[model samples]
Each structure stands twice: as structure tokens, then as C-alpha cells.
Target: MMKVMAFVGSPRKGGNTSKIVNSICTGLKENGHAVEVYYLSELDNVGCKACDSCQANKVEYCAINDKMTTLLPKIADADCIIVGTPVYMLQLSGITKNFLDRLFTFYRRSNHTARYLPGKKYMTVTCNGAPAEAFGNVTEYLNQLFNGSFKMKNVGNIITGNLTNKDDILKQQGVLEQAEELGRKLS
Candidate 1:
């Protein structure tokens, strides 16, 4: 069974994005894969300082000691990484964007032959206040970030539309089901 790390990037706890990710995790767990969910909003994650510390002293280690630093080992070891976020300002939520920025550590590491992570898969879930088509830009950004930057295999993406209210997404049973299926297929 593959170990998966699911990151919920919405700032609202138990919000639409988190609910969908939890469902995905449930499916992965049922399929005998190990899954761990990390809520970015709950973590004290600082944006990447662009310091070359990770590249210099420690080897694959970011110097920042915030909660995000705790994720480096887990992210490196996980076979699959799943990220879910709400669409804000036609892009991923600030929390997710910050988390993505922090991933510069991985990007820098991969630039040299000493890539810490390789052959891993990634999934994305985006919930928007508008229709799914309206948030295609957000999905494309995530796809490019995860695949182009990290070289992770793009497994799939689940987008939920019209999710202004956090609980509004509960009405989209199909989207949640799709997320569950996406998790089941990850490994």
C-alpha cells in the first residue's frame, strides 16, 4: 500500500475543501493505502524566504522551523500527494499559495541531479464560488505547479463549483464521489 499525504489548503476548518479531501482520504484508507491529512490553515507556515539554506547547509532541509518544515520528510517519502483548496481571486487560496511557495525547497533540490523526490503522483481538488469553468485557471495553475515544477505525475483533479458558503459543497455529491474515486486511484 502506498503512503499518501493529503494537504487541505483552505483556511476555514472543516470547510468545503477539507470535507472533500477527507472523503478522498476515506476512500484511500478503505483501499488499504495509508493516508495522512494536514490542514495548512492550522499550521504556522511562513512563505519561502528564498534563502539558499536548504541548498547549502543541511541537504534537503529548509532552515525555517515552522510547521511547514515538519512536512518535508513526509512529502519526500509519500508515494502520492493530494492537495485541496478553495478558489480565491481566480487562484488558489492564500494558504495554498503560501504552501506552494514554500515548496520552492523541493523545486530547488530537483534542479540538480540530487532530486529528493522522484516518480511520485499528485492529485488536486479545487472548490470555487463560481462555476467549475470559471475556476479552470486555478486548476491549470495547480496542475502546472505540481507537474511542471515538481515533476510529479498528474493523477487527476476534482473541481466543485458554486461553493461560496463552506457547506454549499455538500450539495455536490457527484464532486465528492469523484474525489473519493480519485483517491482510490492514486496508488
Candidate 2:
């Protein structure tokens, strides 16, 4: 079974991002794949230190000794990754941006190449308060990061909008089902 690491970028534990990620995990679990879920806010990471220690291979992954120290290794070992976030100001949430910034450790600054991230499978989920098509750029940005920059394979993406409430995703049962189905297809 493939190992999948799912990250919820929303601080709200029960928000749309978390719910969709949970649903995807449920499907992955049903398919006998190992799924580990992590909430960004609860991780308490101090964000990236920009020390380039990880780039220098000084400490393995960014010098910060927070939860990311534990998670970066997991990210490297996992076969697939799923990132879910709610759009803020037509961009990724601050916590999500910080988390992505920390991933700079994977890069080789000399040649702008990443060793561990290439060939990894990745999926994205984006929720916005605007219309579904309004924030297409957010998903494209994520794609550019994971697919263009990292050279990871694009497994899928769930870009949706008009979810203003915390539990707004619950009402979109169809989207939740699609998320689960996406998970099942991975395995």
C-alpha cells in the first residue's frame, strides 16, 4: 500500500479544508493505504528559519526543531502528499505559505533543483469564499510549486469556492464524495 501524507492547512480543525482532507483519508484507509493526517495550526512550527542548514545538509531538514523537524522526514518518506487549504486574499493561507516556505530545505540552491521532491505524487484541494472559478490561480500556483518547480506528478486537484462558513463543505456532499473517490483511485 502506498503511504500518503495529508496536510490540512486551515487552522480550524473542522473547517472545509479539514473535512475534505478527512474524507480523502477515509477513502485511502478503505483502500488499505496508510494515511497520516496533520493539522498545520496544531503543529506549532516556527516556520522556516532560512538558515539554509537543510540545503547544506547540516541538520537534514531546516534547523527549526519544531514539529516540522518530525514532519519533513515523513514528507520525504511518503509516497504521496495531499495538501488542502482555504484561500485567503486570493492566495494561500499564511500557515500554508509558511509551511511551503519551510520545504525549501529540499532544494539544492546551487542549481535550483530539488532531490527528494521530484517524482513524488501530489494532490491539491483549494476552497474559497468566492465563486468556484474565481480563484483558479491559487490551484495553478500550487500546481506550479508541486508540478513545475518540484517536478512531482500531478495526481489530482479539487478547486472549489463559495464556502464561507466553517462547515460549508458538509453541504457539498458531492465534492466530499469526489475527494474520497480521488483517494481510492490512488491505490
Q: Pick the candidate with the highest TM-score.
A: 2
- Looking at model 2, report the run of 10 residues with the lowest lDDT sum: 56-65
Evaluate all candidate structures by whole-model CA lDDT and list the values in order: 0.82, 0.89
- Give me the displacement of residue 129 in model 1, in angstroms: 0.5
lDDT, model 2, position 62: 66
Model 1 over residues 1-187: C-alpha lDDT tens digits? 9999989998898889999999899889889999899999888786888878876656556888788888887788889998998888878889898888877677655444325455788889998888888888888888877777667788888877888887987898888898788777666
**What does candidate 2 score on TM?**
0.96
Kindly give the number of clashing pairs for every candidate.
Answer: 0, 0
lDDT of 2 by residue, 69-186 (tens): 8888889988999999999987999999888998898878889898788999999999999988998898999999999889999998998888999998888999999999998888
Tell me how far the alpha carbon of residue 11 in candidate 1 is from the true structure, in angstroms, after superposition. Answer: 1.3
